[model samples]
Target chain A: MLAESLALSAVLFVIGVVGVLIRRNAIIIFMCVELMLNAVNLTFVAFSRVYGATGQVFVVFVMTVAAAEAAVGLAIIIAIFRHRQTVNLQNINLMKG
Target chain B: MQPYYSLYYTFPFYLFGVIAIASALAFVTRKSPVTAALWLVNTMFSLSVLFVLLDAQFIGVMQVLVYAGAIMVVFLFVIMLLNLGHPSEIADQRGRWPTLVAAAIGILMIAEIMVIARGKVASRFQVPPDFAAEQMQQYGAIGTVARPLFNEYLLAFELTSVLLLVAIAGAVVLGRRKDTRAG
Candidate 1:
């Protein structure tokens, strides 16, 4: 059962990684990153069943960090959109050097 | 292995597991940001169910409250704010090379997880007998989680708050409109 859950978590994580690599929209990429973070949280909770509440504690921290990342990341994305007028990655190559 | 309890317990796990994976796949493939965010919310709810099945009740609740509730709302707000009208314009522009590379990396990750799942890597970390009963007796669910957060992880807890404050400030700063007249 644990192994099955862990396998599912890995699959989710891989999907998130693929989303990040293949997607162009910044918001979608950010959502994919959130998906990856949730996958890690799932793994932590699964391990907590074996090792106790320590993994759960780590998940809280991960959640905190994810919230912070979302705030700062979206802000950056908004700022970028304001300047460049587009959130597509292919067009925002100001630092092409 | 009581048939009734085993069947009852295992059913939801499998159910939510399938829901999470399916929603996650939908989330990544959706061209519209709002639709993608909605699918991610579905994934988050399914994961919370999985967490609850794992006996991390507090984490599960927090997953719903934080991930599905607050964070997803913020994402939706941003998506609406951006007003990305044309989905076709911002759709995936990557060539086949990225797809192939991503597939290779994903295969490597699955292989690594397969080894671990097969108990070839770490067999010593098996769950102790009556772990659920022992944990319930020792600290209960919420108490067990709170003790570490308030005691051993006290400094980290405080630091996380500080980090949140800084993040808030940074977001405001970055998100503010620049004064063109100042230059």
Candidate 2:
């Protein structure tokens, strides 16, 4: 069961990664990042089942960090959209310099 | 009989795993950011079920409340705020090369796990007898996590709050109207 949960988490993580790599939209990329984080959280909880409550404790902290990331990330996206008038990555070349 | 019982028991876990993976797939393939966010929320709900199945009740609830509730709402709000409904509906994919590379990478990862954890998939679903149940009985659901959060990890917990505060301030600063800024 542990291995299965880990496997599922791995698959989900891979999907998030593919999403991030292929998707052009900034918000979708952030959502994929969140999916990756959630996959890690699942892995932690699965291990917690075998090891102890420490895994659960770590899951809480992961949630905290994810929330913080969301707040800051979405704000960055909003700001970029305001400046560039679009959220498509190909159009934004300010960082190319 | 033993194998069937294990399969029966692990059925719900697999069900949820399929739901999560499918929703995640949907989330990435959609054209509209709004629909994608909604699908991501579905993925979150299914994962929450998996968390509960794994016995982390508190984390499970937090998964729904924090990820699905607060974060997704914020995502949709940003999408709507920017009027990203129709005009900004760009292509999900860039081109053929990136898609091929992504597929290769994903296959490599899943294959890595399979090779490393070979022959163990048959006996994989159950938690070690009572690791979490014992803790749940002693500290209750939330308290099991709360004790660690308050004691050994207290400093980290406090720092997360500080991090959230900083994020909030940063968001406010960045989200302020450009017209109002003199610079």
Candidate 3:
């Protein structure tokens, strides 16, 4: 059971990594980042199953931090969209200057 | 959790695991951010059920409430508010280098999973559940978590609230705009 759950988490996290690599839309990339975080949370909960509730506590803290991150990240995305009228990462390469 | 594994536990565990992976695949591949966000919600729901299967019931419920309910909703709201549903604008095919890198990472991860699935790591780190069971008997599941959270991790917990306050303030400042063009 432990191995299976960990394997599942790994696959999910890999998918998220691939998403972040491939997706052009900034919002979609952010969503993929959320997916990666969720995968890590799953691994934490799975370990907590064997160790104790300490892993679960970490999961709770992770969720809180993720919420905060989402709020700020989306707000930044909104600001960028307002400035450039698009959310495509390919097009938002202002750092090249 | 049963002392011994049974088909009952194994069945739902695999089911939710499959659901989570599939939904996450769909989430990443979808063109429209709105549709992708919805798929992410499904993935989160399946992950929540898997959490319950792992005997972390409170964490499971929080996964549903906080991730599937709150976070995904915010994602969808932003996707819509920005009018991001135009699937055509998104270039669905990424270049060859990213595809190669992603494949390399995926293969490496699969190899790691195969090593873990060999059952050696599981046997070594598998601590007896006596400590957690004793705590659960005393404080129940949620309380088992809460006790440490409010005691040992109290400072960290308080700091998390402060972090959230800063996040909220930062979001408001970033989102706020001066009057320029009337929408």
Candidate 4:
């Protein structure tokens, strides 16, 4: 039973990874990253259930970090879009230097 | 008997697995960012259900509340503000052999790790008689998690608040529109 949960999380994480690598749109890529974070959250919860309270504590902290990451990441995306007028990501190479 | 055991647990796992996979497929195939965002929300909700089945009720609720509720609202706001429909021209992804190869190799490495881990877990799966009942009692409610989360992890909680504050400030700073007015 628990193993099945782990399998589902793993499969979802893999799919998120494929989305991040294969997609060209910056917004979609970031959404995939968020999916990966949610996958990790699922794993943390499963392990917590398997072991004890410690895993749940980690899940809480992870949720906090995920929220923070979303705020900062989206802000950066918006700024980049404002500057370049597109979120293609490949077009923005100003940081390559 | 085997079917009963499978039905008892594996059914929910399979159900959520299907939801997660279908939403992911929709997310990837959809051209509109808003459409993809909606599918992503569905995916998050299904993942939360899997968490509940795992007995992580606190995290499960947080998954729905924070990711599906709060964070998704922000994602949708950005998608709407951008007004991005579909790309006017399909971005050329051809001739990116190296990147594709790298991704395939990375995936293979992860698969290998999972296979190894599965072996380890299978070897350790000697069932104690009361294990199932005890697990049910342990995860049947969230009170067990609340006590320690507020106690031993108190400092971490404070730090998270600080992190959120900084994120808010950073988002405002970055997202504020720059005016072209002369000084």
First chain TM-score for all predictions: 0.97, 0.97, 0.98, 0.93
Q: Each model's TM-score, in the order given?
A: 0.93, 0.90, 0.92, 0.86
Candidate 3 lDDT score at position A42: 87
Specify the poorest-scoring 10-residue window by lDDT in model 4 chain B: B86-95
Clashing pairs in 4: none
Q: For all candidates, state DockQ relative to the true structure.
A: 0.78, 0.73, 0.74, 0.56
Which ten-residue region of model 3 chain B has the weakest summed lDDT?
A: B116-125
The candidate that achieves the highest DockQ relative to the unseen native structure: 1
True contacts kept of each: 0.82, 0.82, 0.77, 0.54
- For model 4 the interface RMSD, in Å, equals 2.9
Q: Which of the predicted structures, 1 or 3, would earn the higher lDDT when compared with the native? A: 1
- Considering only chain B, what TM-score does candidate 2 achieve? 0.84
Candidate 4 per-residue lDDT over residues A2-87, each given as its tens digit: 56667667767877877776777888888889888877777777666556657777877887888899899999999999999888
Second chain alone, TM-score for each candidate:
0.87, 0.84, 0.86, 0.76
Q: Pick the candidate with the highest TM-score.
A: 1
Model 1's CAPRI class is medium
By lDDT, the candidates rank as: 1, 2, 3, 4
Best by lDDT: 1
Interface RMSD of each: 1.3, 1.7, 1.6, 2.9
What residue pairs are clashing in model 1?
Answer: none
lDDT of each: 0.88, 0.87, 0.86, 0.77
Candidate 4 Cα misplacement greater than 4 A, ranges: B1-8, B87-103, B119-140, B180-183
Clashing pairs in 2: A1-B124, A1-B125, A2-B124
lDDT for each residue of candidate 2 in B1-183, tens digit (9 for 90 to 100): 122237656899999999999999998898888888999999999999999888788999999999999989999999889888773467657799999998898899888866875655346565566657687889887888888889999898888888989989998988888889996
lDDT winner between 2 and 4, please give it.
Answer: 2
